[model samples]
Target: MLLQSPTQTVMSLEAPNPLSLHIIHLLMLIKPATSGGRFRVLRTAVSFFYMDPTLMSLRSLQLPSVNTGFGGSADTRTKDLPALQSALLQLTQAGILTDEDSNGNGLNIMPVTCVRAAMLIRCNTLLRGHSGVCLELVQALLLLLRKGMTPIVPLRGSISASGDLIPLSYLAGMLEGNPDIRVRTSTSFVLSADKALELAGSEPITLGPKEDLGLVNGTAPSATLGCLAVHEANKILLLAQGLVAMSCEALLGKAENYHPFISSVCPRPGQVECSATILHFLEGSSLVQSLKEEDKFKPVELNSASDNPIIDIKSGEVYSGANFISSSVANGMEKSRLALQMVGKLLFSLSSELINPTLNRGLPPNVVADDPSLSFTTKLIDISMAAYLSELGYLANPVTPHVQSAEMHNQSINSLALISGRYTLQAADVVAQMCVAHLFAVCQALDLRVIHMTYLKALRTKLVSKVLPFLNGFDDQVAEGIYERLHETIVKSWNASACFDLQERCKIPSKETIPVLRDHLEEHEMHFVSTRPLQRDLENLAYPTFTQTRSEFFVKPPTKQFLGRASLGLYCFVREELGVHFHQGLVEHPGRKTSGKVNGRKKRTIGSWVSIIFTALTNDQVWGHLVEALGSRTCQVRLV
Candidate 1:
């Protein structure tokens, strides 16, 4: 009956909704707290309406949580009606839930669709606590979503068996009907396979287990990583080429060293190609054109390589071996490191060029010669920072062998190619950051000088605006100190600064920046020349085991005989200025006289050759005059 009392009477407005009525009955029995705690009663009323159905269904069927409480494994039994009701009431009263209508039923809800969706959300949230394959899967799913492709059901067995399983599964779930899967989706719910075909007037894909597995599994993480590594390595190679060109220009190196005629003479592909690239990179500009031939390449010690693993899907076997090893990439990385080091040193010289009052090219020290208090020290600091960062990158280059054994008995542990892939990615990022810093320093130095071309000025302005925006003026130390942090952030900027500047400065419209940089590298003798054809040799070379038990297993490559037939495989061209030097000896004049003659004379020649005809038959200079004489004469000498 409708009552007229001091309190409100709650009743069901609809007949089919028993849960709503149950909620109304509870609200009527529990009055709003008199102590201004009205929010609590309202919460209980809402909670009861949502949980009532699940509770009532269980009560009618009789669930275990009612008699023994909510304590049971998956085997014990389903939840009880009373306990479920109590938990829901407590949650609602605390304002931890909301009322949502679905299928004409009042249910307690959060922001997601189903239980799996909630778990996916939790999985991503838990990423802050852990990493590796799970994180990689999430990232891949994110990528797939960006491209508007949906993944199907994920299998537990497939991830352990294949490299891309987990990631694909995560991606598929996110793309499916469950909105809570929370992958970046363009629209809510995937219309279901049936509806999609009808709407589009096309047959629906009835995907099987094998097809689904094929879609998600079989990804070459290591290979792709290697591919990405190669891509990044290419960039570093370009930057290294640029550094070489700058050095060539600074040292006044000759262009003939990079001539196609010279590269054609030697058939080794990498050498010829590298030489060609360097030459192309430095095609124009007054600096490179002015250099003489014999002024390139400085001697140093370095070595590097990249490795990957392979799998045979048909045989259900993972033959962990190298499909491709990046010896060329590693070598390039090391060489670039050394080349950039020298470039950094040359950059330091620019500070001296501007600082010395007598040698100044009309520019002041610190490039701020107008300000007496600010000295070249500020500019020198930038150079030092570049050098330090270059060293950091140099340290990253190493001969890393691919390890493929097994991860757990399930084989899931060892297939983790993301380890190497992520590392290479990070290293490449570091290299890019270092190059940008160096570029910033160069721009600063150039800004103080007379900019010859409009393109150069324009490029310089653009580069400054994006790469070094914080350097608003000359009086900002905070901006300078943050350069390292900026580099660590892995920012990338592709502009016409390099291209336009080189073209306008060199007056060569047909040439590109990469080619010019390569040409300049050859001019400076920083380019490595090989005697054998690179691709041919690579074809004959045996793929190394991606996973080896012992390091010595690689002592003799399986395809050595096959590779040997390729002819003059890898050879280095050493320039004269970069020749080896020795610094250990004593010299005396022939002034000592004995018995009216210079009997105790010690005349040591710096350039004379003394050949010891035993064992190695090595040569040494005994006297100063002979060595000095040898130094004066120019000869093409080869030693084995």
Candidate 2:
């Protein structure tokens, strides 16, 4: 039977549901001091039920008193009962909230991250087995996750010190079925709060005494963003290593800088690990040269940890500390940006070398025919590489020190870790593009060298012997045999154009011919050049050609998607069209191959060679520029 107040009015109703019956049972348990008090409790309970039918399970719940008075004594509540009730009433009423208002906007965080951060807070609280939150609240969180409902939370309003109150209140509002609040579906569509709840088959949950407090107090936002940033940054580092190695091979650079002995002397863990990884990639490569005294290498530095106020689970204590700040992650990203900038700079230098006549050994100026009006020049390639490098220079500025605090006086200091992470991602993307440009230029240079080898026979012999000494003992007949086999493979596999076909060329007639030979003779001539000769020569001579129609020339540019696909060093021009043999055994050194092992190790492949060369190039550029920037180097080595 339910207890009734003297002033209570009865109403006719249909049969009650399981949830409504549970609410009536809870009403019977409460014994208020006066009719007014009983009426207030009844109204509040009914309001909670309407807001969230899931609160029915919380009918037997009891909350820890806020007035437990510091040391958890039971008697102290006598003096603080009224104050506690007042505070709880204020907190519950605050749930009528929304981030979108006439004066300000909502949080800019993605719906997924916002929901994930909230989930992290809940998990942390439950795992500690404290925070005074009820089992029903746990069930409600699990239901939210299972149903894939992402509550809209504010990014700017979180003070973080007062437990991220304003932002988290919006989340709490969603759970209590605040009609004014909105939710985002897993597909990223926004829906009305009630409509979303119905579709998810989830009812809203009422917040018990300290449940609101438990939901907001932690470093979830900072930690989540920081963790994501760290993960992406690590991947960029791996990719950067490959880019560095390719750049090194393109520039004909030495590998001794990454030798273990050099890193072992200094013994910085990050540098040592970086050196080992780079050296492993360079193994068995013919392109990488021995280190000279003039060559310099930079030391590497990397960090993989998060910073402070960690919750100690064993003691169930929240230790107030600096762990919530993410300066370390931001600093690491800043360094990565600098490293990416160095790669961009090196690419610019390599581009210059490929185009300038005097610097590219014996290659033609602009890497085209002597008559520039008839051939494709590398001018556009150089300009595009410069543009990428300039963008990287702008992105390399550190974001760690650019933040200012604004939340009352409580949050007096701030870390721009999130911003730093965003900048790092952008810089990494640009670095990948720059690497593609460098690879294209290198492949073009190699093609030109092979095509004009009749005039460059002495230089070609020297280069081939220096880069691939294992072919030194082969007779002309034997070498020709190898060339024939390689030519067959290239003809079958080649995909890109082998040479530019002359679309009809215009010719001007003399004035005398136009007037006198109008009917008897032709006034002008047009010529068309076929690429068959170059294509035939590429197969017969075991050489590669950079062939395309005038209309097709310079059509492809380095893009993020293109770079992502090309990072493994396999592309139309470099791999299929050129063939591995045209690289003069730089990719697969014949001497390094054994029946089972070479030097007691497995033989490396063409892809491994490309990765190592790019990684070494990237490392040299980053560390070299860093040393120069710090005024530690008296003279920088010029790539030209």
Candidate 3:
């Protein structure tokens, strides 16, 4: 006879959210038995016990209804009372009851000792559905969470089309309150799946075949990482633009190239808009105004277009096409580097002028160096460092082609959208670091006495103390060594995630930083026309003093309709080739004409063909390459 608790026995089944608790137990039971894997069953059970119950138990578990009367009995299928009784009887036989007590008060005869083992069996089941090996899945899940923020594993890493099995498994283990796992600890949290349902009284996350596909098919993780990098680079670009403009102002650089007329002449949206914005930033500066007599700065701007991919949500189709390619961003980045290079060279000029006793504007040579022996050497070294950094920035321009030719056919190509963004970011990052280095040198030359007037004096003082301590004028060797050390610090800070942080700190209110420059050219100073002016009109047209020219001649307009073959072929072959060789002076000329008679009059008949004819061109390599690229095609043509 089963014995009751010697003292007292009470059966109390009521619990808060009883439905949820029941679902938890039910899931725990069926999950292991149905998944049919020893490892999976155990892992799932472990996770269930450890995971937050609220996140797990709120969803109702539905079990299929089946008849167990050992016959095709309609009545048995209707009720199946005997099956229910038999199950309860088995539970009693297993010592889950105290013989129902003398007064019919149900209670356990003895406390259960192996509860952990029972719970673990279920955790294993849920873990099994993820991958074949439950133990490894559990281990990987734990490791993933420990990796810190954004533990959501990039779903692209999984080869499973069944679902986001890897991430789903981790999420399951997390929700189930698995003891073997750890979550980010916080004082307050609102989030769970199951308990969340009961609180709002809603259904669980439903899954259908299409729904499953939607859940796991996209490469959001890869895209997110790429986009985040792009976002960050864009921010740095913004700041760099500001810094470049500031440098331009301080050095008395021209702002006319950014005017509307200059930018509109090219008709590139990014080029025009950016130039206008930058010019606006430099408005009303004293230093720029004073330098008007010296021809120190000239207006400069670049046009850029960004290409990315877009998903058509309304059509429910993924149209993989180039939206914005960063060729423009690259061009702009390169031009910005050029602009900065010019600025650095000018800074050196200004610094040298300050040091020469005859040219010094009441300031000592090398700014702070009082001794004649050290001043020039020290100043020159610092100037060279800045120039070197600027050169590095200019050289950092990514040379990757926007479209690559297919090995089998020149007509096919793939858009390196992510690659483009990545390169742009890398280039921008390097350029920004260079700017920081240049800024550091400039602040140092201004010296300690200028601190009260300049807001960056504090940063300059700290950087000097930490990296380069001032002394007597420096010779070339000492100067190069100092610059090298400074560059190293910039690199170290960047790799350590400190440079971005420090830059954020330096961007304070403008009122605190001393005004160093001005903006003379406004955006309205630019304009655009469809056709370039006639040779004679080019001289007559009123344009900015810093006007530059770009010319393009096309024999025919390209078809606007989306021809996949043409898209693949033209882009891979001509589009890219044209961008490179167009400015190199290659002329796309119509083919030769034949003398013939038409009607009663003598007429010249054109072959109606096209070919690339380079002026004064000696290279047959390009022609050979084009022939190989085009294969044996003889119909409609493109020549670059």
Best by lDDT: 2
Give the per-residue lDDT digits (tens) of candidate 1, residues 1-640.
0101111112222224423221222122112100111111111221100112343344453322222222122133434433432332222122111222221122432211112221222222212211111222333333332333332221212211234344333333332223322222224334343343233333323222122222233232233333344444444544444544433433335556677777687866655655665565455434434235411111110010011112121232222332223233334444443444444444445434433433433233433312324223235444545555566455454423333433233332233343444345455555544443333333233323322222233333332334343233424564444333332221111112112221131222112322333343365455344313322222122111111211221232221121110000100000011111111112121233423212232343212111111111111111222222223332111100
Q: Candidate 1 — which residues are off by over 4 angstroms? A: 1-161, 175-180, 185-207, 250-268, 289-407, 412-415, 447-640
Better of 1 and 3 by lDDT: 1
- All candidates' TM-scores? 0.34, 0.49, 0.30
Candidate lDDT scores, in order, read 0.30, 0.43, 0.29
Tell me the lDDT of candidate 1.
0.30
The residue-level lDDT of candidate 1 at 592 comes to: 32
Worst 10 residues of 2 by lDDT: 32-41
Candidate 1 backbone overlaps, count: 42
Across 145-236, the per-residue lDDT of candidate 3 in tens digits comes to: 22220111211222212111233332332333332222221221223334433333333332211112222222222122233333334334
Scored against the true structure, residue 624 in model 1 reaches a CA lDDT of 25
What total of clashing residue pairs does each candidate reach?
Answer: 42, 21, 39
lDDT of 2 by residue, 1-640 (tens): 0111112111111224222211121112111100101111111121110011123223432222333321123234333333443353345334333445211234354336434544533433333333434445545554565566666654454423333344455556666676666777667666766777777787876564445555544444444444444433444444345445544544445788798888778987666765655555444444458555311111110110111222233343433344434455456667767866775786678678766755654455556533334444556667777887888899999876666664443446656655565666567667666665556556555444433333223323322332233234556675555444433333222211222221110001111112222221121221223334433332332222222211122232221121211122432334443332222222123444435433333445434444544554433333332222223222222111
- Order by TM-score, highest first: 2, 1, 3
For model 3, the stretches where C-alpha displacement exceeds 4 angstroms are: 1-149, 152-213, 254-261, 264-267, 290-428, 442-640
